[model samples]
Target: MKDFLTLRLYARVARLGSISAAARECGLSQSQASRIVADLEDGLGARLLSRTTRAVVPTEAGAEFLARAEAILDAIEDARNVVREGEDLQGLVRISMPSTMGYLEVIPRLTGFTELHPALRLQILLEDQRQDLVRDAVDVAIRLGTLSDASATAQKITTIPRVILASRRYLDKAGEPITPADLTHHRIIGGPSGVAAWAFEREGEKVAVDLQPHISVNDNEGAVVAAIAGMGICSTPCRRPRPEMLDGSLVPLLTDWARPPVEVHAYFPLGRQTRIAARSLVAYLKAGFGEPV
Candidate 1:
């Protein structure tokens, strides 16, 4: 009989589209994972994955096998749950979210969660870049912007308002702009898109401004630091840096002119059977974070 563990590993590799990522998830070395997959292909006499420098994609046979593999894993979990029904919630629940949000929002409240489920293990991965739910083995994810993946199920956590901000020193130095048009003249600290266009609305009227910032940073924290250092003004989600605002390190700008709110969502992998522990945690986050949908 084929080893069920090896089959589970193969399913994870196909889902994540990276041997290294799957290796990390399965607690195996990258070389070992690669060799195992190669052995499976040889045994079946079919190529399972097309590997490139950037990513690994499943072949037709591999894709077909993946669906069945997932089903088998799900069935196995269901069986295990039936056996462990009387015990406390115990197992790992991996989560991914934006680094800044994790620090400002989730991390502070993590102890409360751990206290509720002492036997459960929480693995939180903080990253600003997007992550694949299956590939990364993340049971749940907190996303700030639009979700393009149709394969995942999402629940709205709250709507985050996008707002412009500046340090008092920077505002004093450059003078605060009264209108969106005046932002063009000041030094702007920006992100990857780098001084791109921003939209503002008030009283049912919208205006777009093409801003050219003096400094460009690829990280959210970096932009916040730059703005606080009086480098320039910054645009960020309103929920962040509450302490900074309270302590007078950062100040809001253009409050009367409204910007569109960005939706915050909690997404789980599609088709995979979610654990009772994971479902409970998601519910806790929804209630704790903001206004729920």
Candidate 2:
């Protein structure tokens, strides 16, 4: 088999077009580079280069061999990078999260982390569907609500208080509902799980109401937008509180009757060795969103 060092020196010499120039690029003396090339040619039993006083040029066989040598060196370098990235804290971490969380929470904090770790890279995958960690090869996933699986390890990052909201325009056009009973007559936007019938507690008593929605969406973010566009009232988590609520676009309808808070979590496979890049990213998120428990 051809030696990697010899092949590298041959490629460098071909690129620089001179032994002396290749020597500088390879951090070797000109004589050392020349000898390496000669050794390579001897190993292959072919004259790889034709040298003149002014310049060195590749022979026909040398040109064909140089192409192969360049490819080999490139592959070796790529393999090295993959191994280094896997072993150290300095590589890419693939992470996935819902669109709203990615846009409103994760993306903002990632900017600072990226600046701090120059070699670390983030591959963010945003989707409304719950990601399968092992199947998708994701390093981490941020999810909301109580985790159903007992096997996967999770850290509670934050809690989002649920709120009831409606656009001012919608309320003005269709009239506001004062009580849970009044919601039946008004249009409401529900999410993928449909209009969840929440039981609210007041004065130490629980009251259950089945919600009816005019429009139902697969994602909470979509429901928020629909509610903002004067579609209908929506019961959503505070993490994606209506922008209108902040800027006077939307207003709370029934504050006292809102459901209990929901929790957001960062989940990963149990007992897996957490990569440094993934750990750093999680730490940054916890600092911004509150520490993981």
Candidate 3:
């Protein structure tokens, strides 16, 4: 157990690239962590890490060892999961997702999950950009669009309905568009990149409208807010604007047209080594989405 804990500490130090931070997570002082690492090097007769005032990074040998150590730790965690299945989950789980999905979908579901595993520690990163999961130490990233050649393993969670929307006031001022082509003359609110083209279909007829946004945001929520303020028409998933549509703050356009659904994917940067807790949360999502849990 002592050796196991020491190995765990070393893995955290390597993963974080900060001895002080790793020590803090493991409930050890900086001096203690430093001494432990030094002792580990002395015992192995190897220079495991290159140390500097700014950062502590693994040497070539340490990098190799870290990969093996992480695999061992993951196996141990898997063993624990086998024994403690459905019990309280311990330790940290880092998750990343778009901000709007976090607020509308994931966060609300978290209460039920955390209540069951009160010992778990969650670090949620809500951003519209894709993160370098290995560098950021993210266990799972729930993405709400096409995978589109991302360098990570992805599981298709479910497809969500999409819509092109605008506020009533905006429509009143700009004059409602009759078809996809009319959008060429209208102000458009776009999200980030790769979404500049919007697709619509009706009665086996399909059209893809290329756009240059009058206003662009990196976040979906921002685009929705822009539309609500009567900035322009925006295309996004239906789940986000459900409440706004009901309350008359936003209106779905092109009722005769059907937009392609947004594909939801749960990305695993560690692939087969993804932590059990992260997988558990994804299973909960599968159940919620009416998929096979």
lDDT, model 1:
0.80
- Runs off by more than 4 Å, candidate 3: 23-32, 148-151, 270-272, 291-293
Best by lDDT: 3
For residues 1-293, write the lDDT of model 3, one tens digit per residue: 77777888898899888999989978999999989988988999999899898898999999988888877876876777667788988767889999988887778778878998888888899978888887666888999877663557888887878788899989999988999999998999987545778888999999998888889888888888999999999887765447789998888888899998888889888434878888998887867776211
RMSD of model 1, in Å?
4.2
The 10 consecutive residues of candidate 1 with the worst lDDT sum are: 78-87
The superposed Cα distance between candidate 1 and the true structure at residue 53, in angstroms, equals: 9.0
Off by over 4 Å in 1: 1-4, 15-24, 29-59, 78-87, 192-197, 201-210, 271-276, 291-293
- Cα lDDT of model 1 by residue, 199-284, tens digit: 89999999999987788886667788889898999887766545778798788888899987777788888878776666777777
* lDDT string, candidate 2, 171-219, tens digits: 8999988777788888879975564685576667677778767799988
- Better candidate by lDDT, 1 or 2: 1
Question: What TM-score does candidate 1 get on C-alpha atoms?
Answer: 0.75
Model 3: worst 10 consecutive residues (lDDT sum): 284-293
The TM-score-based order of candidates, best leading, equals: 3, 1, 2
My TM-score estimates for the predictions, one after another, are 0.75, 0.64, 0.87
